[model samples]
Target: MTWNYAYSQDLWPAMISVASTIFLGFYSWNRRNVPGAKAFAIGCLFAMLWAIGTSLEIAAMDFSTKIYWMKFHALWQIPTVTALSCFFIEYAGLGRFLTRRNLVLLSIPALLVFSLMVTNNYHQLIWTSFELEEYVVAKYGIGTWVSIGYANLLGLVNLFALLRLAIRSSRSRWPVAIMLFGQISGRFMYVIDSLYNHIFSPGESVLVVIGLSCSLYAFALFHFRVLDPILLARTIVIEQMSDGMLVLDMQGHIVDINPAATEIFNRPASSLCGRAIVEMMPSDSGIEVQPGKIELTKFEINLGLGDAARYYSLGLTHLLDKSGEALGYLLLLHNTTEQRRSHELLLDKQRVVATLQERERLARELHDSIGQVLGYISMQAQTAQNWAVAGNTGKTVPILSRLSEVAQEAHADVRESIFSLRAGMESEWSFLHALRKYLDHYHTSFDIDTELLLPEELSEDILNPDVGIQVMRVIQEALTNARKHGGAHKVKVVFVEEDGYVIISISDDGIGFNQADLILEVGKHFGLTFMRERMTQIGGSVIIESQPGSGTTVVLDVPIGT
Candidate 1:
């Protein structure tokens, strides 16, 4: 029995008290710079005093020493409760209540208790009677009960303050509530211990409660960031963000749209918040997403109407709850209209520079080829005239033949120049109409029966300018090949759309060359090669079918709007 008593007195309460003191002291130090730190630290100091005084009282062998430390333990009780109450008030954002007049009023009870505890020798106010039990003195008095009731009242007020703060905060409230519950449970057990007089053990069970409460406080501080406003202020930052934001519920209906989103959509927030996302998206933007699916990749879309068309890059994210269940979706839109405009302007400048360079090249070619050919023709005509004056008839005849040959060569050079210029410039409706007329004239000049077929819906807008130019070149080349190489002379030109493609087929009933002969004589089909290359460059294809006796057909397939 003596060994059990020593172990209970020296080991149990000492171990629990020391552990609680170390942890609470460390917690107080860590948050020394936080708001309400001074009040919280004062509470910690009182708690440490309670723990150490209890341990020293347990270790004291004499009744006098035990009684002396008992008073010391009681000395810290009022201060601890008072300081914790102050901490709770500050934590609840009610610091204004801690005025000089209110604080002095609050301090009266603690000061009276301290004076009574120190002057207890003169009168047995705090301890009316005492007796030694289990090598420790246990005291009883009405004053002790009064102090206990008073401390408990202060604790209840602090707990209520914590609950109020938890309910009012916009951030997560569960952590604070959990801490408050822990304190409540600890205080309930302490009341039971004080009433029953060590139903478990003398002051040992209360120390365990204190340790548990301290753990709860630390949990709330670290996990919930109880003293910081980082999570609480997120709503303010999001409200003022520059990029547009829209939040959608699981049904894909817009639930919230911020001011920036309203500005970007050019609509008031009232109009956008309750509408469906599909109804709000611009026509022809081609945005497709499945409901509830997480889409992290962003896409670009052209929005707005006509001349005010603006571009936006959009991203979607899934919003999740604490349990990781998908709640809804968040859409973010960033305006990229200005950047896209600058890019297109840069492309336009490059095209203009390219056109100027091509014009300079044409001028140099005219000077080198046509100009020299005309000069040669003038010299030959002069020579022929001089020979005629000299009466050299034979020499003049041969010179005349040479002059005729030079003139024909110059005519071919002029025709080639005209064709080259037309290929570069034929992009609009006027060019297409003029080309159809030219085709009619060419067939008449060549004495070939020709038929032209065009679709009723064919328009210049359906074709890109660069692709149209290449298409014209390819058609002109095909016609030249059919008229020059083929003997039979019935031709047909057809323009039609099929399977998202614009097909131009030129067919001729003529003596066609063998496909096998193309390998042996590649140079003989240079026109076909050039036609295939031009179509391929513009994301199109060409197919040629020809045989010895059968007709020849060249089909050019270009993607619509390519």
Candidate 2:
């Protein structure tokens, strides 16, 4: 059957579609350079191009004949698909700087399917021949069973491309689902019409139906701005990337530096850029920047903060022009001081732990062997003294003399003290130092009032280590608990040793809940449970008291005398 050669109501839609699409294409292109107006203009242009191209194909062909329209439709359809694909990527929030890598990757299945169509219809290319209908062109090429197969294959590939964009956009919170939706519905109707006409009876007019569908889709696309969200999201994500990126001109001036690079150096991009990186980096950092090549340089640049001693990994490279000559430098600054510090800290902790373990072993051996022997010797000396005082003069003389000799040996062992294991006067100061050191917040984010009440002493003791560690842990937990649940502002902390007990009070003035159940279920919070376990090992207890409005107080008490 042949479609009638007339500009009917059905072709009217195609004409309007083409006109609007071309108008959008030009307007969008013109506004491309406008900041903030780019995505909208681009989307309009995409729709416009598809409309204009499809319209021109229909205008040249007889709409009522399947064979004629089919012959030329592929040429028009390809550009529309290309435009849609580009629109999908941009509309789905890949940003204007979308990598060529991803684009090539997505084109694979489309290329393969197009290849299959060409291979199957060897003499006819992807589309074999055309059948014309009223206001539409339908292709009838493949043999009956293979016709279904080819159509299915085409459908799958088109759907795949669409779904890929939809999923990527979904992940980024950009609602480009409409693009996927429009592609599937518009293409599916056209495919079904071709298939139905080829093997079965002539059914619904696809172009007329799809033209109506496209009108609806275009309406939805332009009105709801269903593909509009991706552009805004691109703005947000680019503002948060790890590596430093700077876009510059032909001169050796700076364009921009991300937040990470700003922190790596002392100054913001506003202050540092356009002023040259030479004045910014440290003199001793062994960095020398010149034009025309990429350079990997290490630097000890002082970021003038509380942590002024830190260093960074400086990556300086020339921004190349199309011909590979240096236009400007793209400097990437990464801080490596933390990595170095962390490595050193691990080694130091390992050594200290090993030394402590060795001392523990020696202390155990001394207490078991020499201490027991000394106690036995003292017992024997007392026995001999008793006999000497009982008036067996001649018999007791040898015994009394031997007792004195044995007593002197016992006294020598007593003089050989293991004070290293205990908290000496120096250990108190060391405890304070250690506690203060642990409390140090490096790149920390928390809001809480911390106070330290320590004595005037530098000492070390086994009981002190045990008590001090448990007390500090309890205070840490209490502070965390207050911040998490109490909703309080002021927190008071106190530490003291009296009556052979080390006592600590961590109180917070916040909305204290009657967490009677939570206290009962303290074993649930692993941190809290571990804390209680730590205190228990040191012969201590952690007590929590709270009332709804008043606030909360946690007291950790440890017995020093065992």
lDDT of 2 by residue, 71-175 (tens): 333333433454444554454434464467865754564455446554644655345554444434344444423434543554465456556544432232233
Question: Cα deviation in Å at residue 50, candidate 2?
Answer: 7.0
lDDT tens digits by residue: candidate 1, 1-562: 1211133444566467657666766676667665565677777788778777777677666677777776787788788778878877877767888999988988999998899888877776787766676635456567778887887888777777777765444243577677777678877887776677556454565475566676677677678776545643464466568788889887777877766788888887667767878788865445455655544333887776687987888888889999999998998888888888898899799679757755675576566567878888889889989999999999899888988887876776567558546655544445356556667766665677778888888874556666776677777777766766776588888889888898889899998878888789885555677677678877999988899989889988989866
Model 1 CA deviation exceeding 4 Å by range: 1-10, 135-139, 227-562
The local distance difference test score of each candidate is: 0.73, 0.53
Worst 10 residues of 2 by lDDT: 416-425
Quantify how close model 2 is to the true structure by its C-alpha RMSD in Å: 24.6
lDDT of 2 at 67: 38
